[model samples]
Target: MKIKDIVNRDVVNLENCEDEAIHIPGLIQPHGFLISIDADKEIINVCSENISQFLDYRYNEILGKRIDDILGKDFKETLREFKSNSLEKKTVFLTYNDQSYALTIHKSQENIIFEAEPNKVPLNEEGNLFESSKRLLSSIEDTNSLKELSQSVATAIKNITGYDRVMIYKFDHEYNGEVYAEVREEHLEPFLGLHYPHTDIPPQARALYIKNLLRIIGNIDYVPAKLYTYVESKVDTLDLSLSVLRSVSPIHVEYLKNMGVGATLTVSLIHKGKLWGLVACHHYSTKFLSQETRNAVKLYGYFITSQIDVRILNEQYEVAKKANEYVDKLSSKSLEFKRDSLTSLFQDDAIYQLCNGSGFSACIDGKVYSNGETPTEEDIRLISEVLFDIQSDGKVITSTFPRQNKGLGSVAEKFPGINFHMLDDTNYLMWFREPTIKNIKWAGDPSKAIEKDKKGLSPRKSFETFTENVKDTSKPWLQPEIDACNKFKFFFQSFLRAILTNEDKEKQRILTENLKAVNSELENIGWISAHDLQEPLRKIRMMASTMLEDQQRFQVTEVAEKRISRMSKSAERMQTLIKDILEYNRASSEEDNFEKVDLNDLLQEIKKELKETLEEEKAELVIEGYLPEVSGLQFLIKQCLLNPIHNAIKFKHPDRRLRIRIFDDQNHSKSDMYSVISIQDNGIGFDNQHNEKIFKIFSRLHSKSDYEGTGIGLAFCKKIMLKHRGFIDAQGQPNEGATIRLYFPKVS
Candidate 1:
């Protein structure tokens, strides 16, 4: 049958063959026919090229004939075995008459069918071996990680040795072998990270590897002849076990056979006269080797292993150099922050200013520090103790105390956090924060467990199983590539630092300009509140004084009392306007004691403060939903809500109640937390044209006579929101109540 016809199908009848003689027509032309005999050498059947070819002998005559008479002893035995076995379909390779044939046997109820074909060997005819090796070397040389180098070495050895599979088998401290890298003929599995038991390659074999450095097994099944020597009747014994180039041990071959491997070539990767690892090559089929080929491959193996050694040195140099650069930059950034000096100016007793940990302080030496509640000396002492331990080992360390330790180092135990690195001999860089769910798992295989697993499974199975095991277990390590990329971190950090520093300076300049503008505006408002508003009140006082003095001549009447009441009302309106302006100014000023305060708690507090106002207005400050937790000043957020909610109640269009709602929006940036609080009112709303105007101080659409007080409430709301790096906007028609939309950013 053709190879394609029998693919994926079961072969039948070959399992039991009664006839000794079988027809094998597909053999070599000179041996076109095959004759089979039973164990007694009796000719059971004969197959010829044509019916006439077998005409010379009748079927009864051939059946009783001794097959060895014509077919020879070897041919008879080969045929006898074919008819005796129980394999339904059999494919076996045999060398007969110096020709190799892939003989396929099929059996039927009445007869046996045999087919034969030549098996071709693959030759390295193109001499692409050196080119393949060179390409592999070039591809791997750029790998800057030990893991990457291991993988590259495994792949290169596979190509150079022409092995079906090759692996970089590293020996652990316990002498257990691990496959750090592997390349296979099939893509079915990976074995790069499997770990195999130490017994796979026994202790004696491992020790021999350290001394010999190179081993080549040409044919695993080959047996060496016994040697005998004598000179002048003196005999000398040669210990084959001690010879580096001696043939492989028979026991080792049996071991491999038990594991199903036909051939293995191992090149020891020696480091300091010990076996660090092996460039292990495996062949599914037996391999034949020439002395010249063996030596050449050994020399090539030496070159590749040396490359790995040198590459590791280069990588260490690179890491140290890059780390030093970043450390220096961090030092420079800290000094720069200190020299700037304005952080002190921005400090307030009630606020925890992150002067030392805002920008550069938070980002020095790959650690981020932030301004929050200042740690106590006790906490600092505990933190120093932990830092001492981490500095010694350069690994993550943590400690904790009950009841929320307030000492300096308590932050380390207070939160689940990770930060550890070698900064210097005396100073180890580290970051400690409360752990969140985000830190428990990250998007990386940093532990390299996958690489380790493959190494563990390598030597426990047959060559096929080992090959398949490796293909299944190997995991590519990319961190070295990523770590190498960190070489540019100096440039990146410096660039970012420069941008941030310049921006800070620019922001200071802008703040100065803003402060000037604000002062000017406040001065102008001062004039309105002091001079303008005062003049109306002064006129009312003078008019009242003159009227009282001339009361006898004027005969005090109801008309006079009404006129006086109108003038007093206008004066009182001016007083209220001045007070609103002062409140709005306070909201917009940058001098507030800003600090972290729970937004939810602040909102509740504001509700309590405005309880009387809300009750009197018969307005339910519904607080429609849960308040969002945000980082801002407690007092400021209280003011933010107070102005808006109070306005909602104060301006209620006589027949309606006030309602406010709060919730968080998830549409913000990944790192930002955004909360929106919308305060809606059933109050007398203004025209859309005045939406923008209402936010300005003293800008009012309704007269004091129509409304109760000043228009500064909305303006104050806008100021407080802006102070928090937030915003507020109004929406409504002239008759409908307004909805003041508030957006509070999650982060500053």
Candidate 2:
């Protein structure tokens, strides 16, 4: 038994094998069973019909060499066993990835033999098709129905294989078929739910499928039916059953014949020992697949079928469980079992906890009773019409909302609603409940349980037994319901952020507008008050001028002269009051620009301006050391200090000369940007109660005979300080002089 004996002529390179000791023929299939292995259990073998190309390695080169030294590195141990055992015929069945192959291993005197044809396919998987298939299986766990599961599988296959189209074709006892699930390119039309008649494929074509478990039609247009030479019966020429593999299922031949398909790879889905369906992957153009690739795809098909079975079983369970849960949650809490109360069943946050349903609705008579979004009366009526059309016994239909209801086609304005047919009578038959909000009442007493518990010490003690059932945490968790219920959480978070931002911006805008209005009002108040009072003051001033002018001319009467003199003095006082009021208004309108002004230099200049008055009045004006620059309206601030200085000098006591001092200090207030400016004067000071009154326009504490001018000086000074975002305050009593403090913000 030599390796050369079984080698097929096509598989043997005579030129390369010239140095070999012997060559044996008619022993085994050449390419079908030559084992190639390396050290570290890395195996490379070709079970392919064209084995010659794969076994190009030198005979001696692979004897003791490791996979890294010959074939490759990091090969799975499972693959090493495949090549090693495949050579000895120890394993008659071959399993790669997940698909199992019933292979005949024939060992003759020369080499091993594998009696199985090979095929190739590209699983939509970009890389490592096995891993991709595993993920697809895991994701399929969430599939709800057979149709859904099939659809998921189709999509998964297409995604992993990068195929143009993949379909799950369900066949009946007859050859009739329907596309249960399908995934196609975006540009291609969907084949969902499209049914083809049984005669479309014919009976003879179906018989072929029974023999050809898996077939790869690489090029449908060029698929030439191979003549079976083993068939020697002349009378059974037209019978496809006589051949080892029937002529590519007559149903498929006819299907391709009608569809003009270019290529196809079909894997029969056999479940429970019965022909279930076929996972049909199609290509629109001539396609070529390596045998290795086809094997990978078959493995995927096997895994998908298993997953489908599990998912279908789980789906049945889920449906029953969900229906029971829904009935329990709604029936017990519903007011008088009124379905409309379902709208109030769950809070907004709880609505999102339900499932993949983004928005929810409960329809009565096909009319939406209530939903998360507002539904117009007409929309409700349309929905009612659709529900009315469903006369079945609470049968569920998985369909898009728009397709079910014409009124719901546009998702733009109206929120999409899913239809759940609850078999009920004509009267109040349907209740619109939002799926997103259903679970909310589960945690609390949906029907006034909280209010009922108010008299009790614990809220839980207040809830009814029915409420406890709904909130049972012991129940197993369902992902769909959770996804549906959690939608409310996102809605709440987003809504709060939007509203707060708008409100904050609105408040800021309002404040700015109000400040502008106040500023305008201040100007108008100043102008109106000053102008309105000037008229009376003008008349008085005119009368005084005339009285003084005519006093000597009309002096024939002494009593009359005295009265005229008094009238003139009073008129002059009135004019002074008017002037002071106007000056207070002017000070508010005027402000000085901030600049570096030496405090000591300013004080020195003021002293020089008033030196004569101070010298004659025997007043002493003193200033302290170097002053820092402070933010202020320079001219206004000067006027502010000047008014107080003049007042001190004017009120100088006859008993002693006046003393005035100006200085700055730290820790003036909580504000750090402000510099404190204080002036203290010892003179004839008024009572403490009159401090505020002195800063009011025309508010005179002293009689006209005592004071020399109108009482607007201090008021004008206060206005100047206020305009600079500053303030002024005075302290004084009867015998002692006053001290006035001014605060100004620094420019920098």
Candidate 3:
């Protein structure tokens, strides 16, 4: 019958078979009888319809009865012990009517299921299980190569099960199956090395294989026995996931019949919780294995699964070793050079052999470099864009056939395989492989494996060998090759970071030297300009003074005399500006003229120099406390002190006594870093907001008519303090008083 008729009605074609509820089939193979007891109540609730064939009572009569009523008190006690211990599953041998059966009990949902099948294998065969398994495991351990391990397993299982053919089938990344190793009877055609598409075993079947671990079909043509449940018990569908006598799918049976297989046994090999492959045994005629024999085979499968990871790693050890050597060489070379390291390394043969590629190409700093054989520039650019679209975390993107990507189909023939590694957005390295022709042998025509007729979809009715010439596809990239590329990408990125860091340091050093040279030239120009302007100012002052003296000789009027007086004053102010400009320049350029100066002695000199102005303004210069010695240029320190004291006397309020205090700030002297000296006066103080602005050259708060001096006085003070690595601060409010404090750095 078509699968749609016997299986779930939703399964009309192979595409929909993945959704089939094979785990809850509600039927058992006719060779065994199943009984489910309510775990909490200790009562029988479900049984196979064929149970009457083995026992005296029918399934209907057995259902809804207590376990002790059917199997006696001793059996119920055993069941209770099994439940209390919480064992996964237990198998016990039971004899009734002079017939022996293996009774397997396991928990399913809220029920405890008991599946019994006839034990027909000889006791001697079951007795040798442990020793035989030990020998098989030893053989596998001694075999270093993966192929040798597969062949040894196939040969050993065939000898144990007495099957016509035993094959070690392996699945690729895409779940496609390949007959990796095989041992068969001489009369049978060899099915070794034949490939099968993943569709042959849908996702649901693979999932069941992982869950159940092992399955055996005693007679492929045998009828399925339906399960019978008590109506009042309300068990809708029985879970046959852990049932050893679970009925096989009709579609699977039909597929096997087409291959002329009478019975089959499949053992799942699991690694890291995933279904790795299977040990498939096929018999040309009907066969059945006792529970003891099946358990022995399962133990062998477990041994193989446990060793799969280690064996695979052992196989790739040599490849990884060589890749490490290449990485070390490339990284060392990259470090030896400061620039063009990537460009130079890209030309080396080591990069091409790093991943065992036929060709290599690199895009660095907008330049493309190539070695060995590579695709055209245009094709390379297109491939790079595609790789960029899928780039992630410096992962190596590998493709066995470039044609698989729609954008790369046209260039696939030029380079069928590629390993693309993107270092960044605009730079990458790619390795390529040329097209290789392979003659692949499939068990059947994979393209037509699943056929549709008027009834529904069906398996192909052919097992004869089908060979096809597969072209434009290179040998697949191995995991070690991909791993090597990833390692190289990491080294390349690290090298670039190191190079960029060193380059930035070198650039900073060059810029610092250039800045120093530019400052020296500007200082020289300012000094020359200030010295040259002094001569012109002296000539102008002389001319105005002579005109003032000769006013009566020229009969000069009152306006004329005033004009001469104004010209003389203008020239005098110009002379003061040039003098202050020269002082500012000297402060910045004279760095080696530092000396220890006594501030008390310097203040006495300043008071003597300003004696005439002090007497005229009627100001009091009070030295509040003893001053400390500090290190600075002597003349610049004099100007630093002279400017502020003069301004304090000049800007004093007219209504108040011009009392000026000259003292060392005791609070500032307590600190070891700096000494502070303050000049305070009751003057027409400026706003506090102009504290910073007033220090700039030529910055004046009052007009020239009110304040008769160059605006460079405070600016000169700031520059001198800066030359001594010191600081100056101004604090005041309008019409109150102003205090200018100078902080001189302490000499160590």
lDDT of each: 0.52, 0.54, 0.82
Give the least accurate 10-residue stretch of model 3, judged by summed lDDT. Answer: 1-10
Model 1 stretches with alpha carbons more than 4 Å out: 1-160, 172-176, 187-189, 221-242, 245-255, 313-322, 334-748
Q: State which candidate, 1 or 3, has the greater lDDT.
A: 3
Tell me how far the alpha carbon of residue 521 in candidate 1 is from the true structure, in angstroms, after superposition: 54
lDDT of 2 by residue, 1-748 (tens): 1122122233123222222112222222221323332223332221222333344454333433343453233233434455566543332344434434333333433222234323333454346666666777786676666777777777777765556889988886644566788999888766666555444433434544554456666665543322111111111112222121222432234446445567787777776665677888888887655554555666656765676657666765664455445434543442422333334653332242244333344443344444344356676566655665654554333333444445546431243333344434542222222222123212123333111222221112222222222111112224444332333334323433554566688789999899878977976876687678778767866775676678767453677667766776776776667666666666756645666766777888999999998888888998875566766656766888899998898887778879998888565673476777888888877788877888887678778688688778888887888887878888886668888887777657
Per-candidate TM-score against the hidden true structure: 0.32, 0.36, 0.87
Best by lDDT: 3
Ranking the candidates on lDDT from highest down gives 3, 2, 1
Question: Candidate 3's residue-wise lDDT over 1-748, tens digit each?
Answer: 1011112334444455566677777778999898898999978888888988888888878788897788766577779888999976888887767788888888998989998888887668954766677778789878987778888878778777888999988998889899999999999988889999787888888988987877999888999887877667878777778778888777788899999999999999998888889999999899998777788778777767777878888988887788778777887772443676666778888887877788899887777888888988888888787777776774445555455576567676677778888777899889998778888888888887777787677778986778989766787787888888888888888877888888888899999999879988887887788888889888988877777788877788999889878888898988888887877777777857778999889889888988988898988888877888999888889998888888988889999889889887877654567787888888888899999988998988889997787889898899888888888999988999899999987666
Q: Model 3, residue 245: displacement in angstroms?
A: 1.3
**Which candidate tops TM-score?**
3
Between 2 and 3, whose TM-score is larger?
3
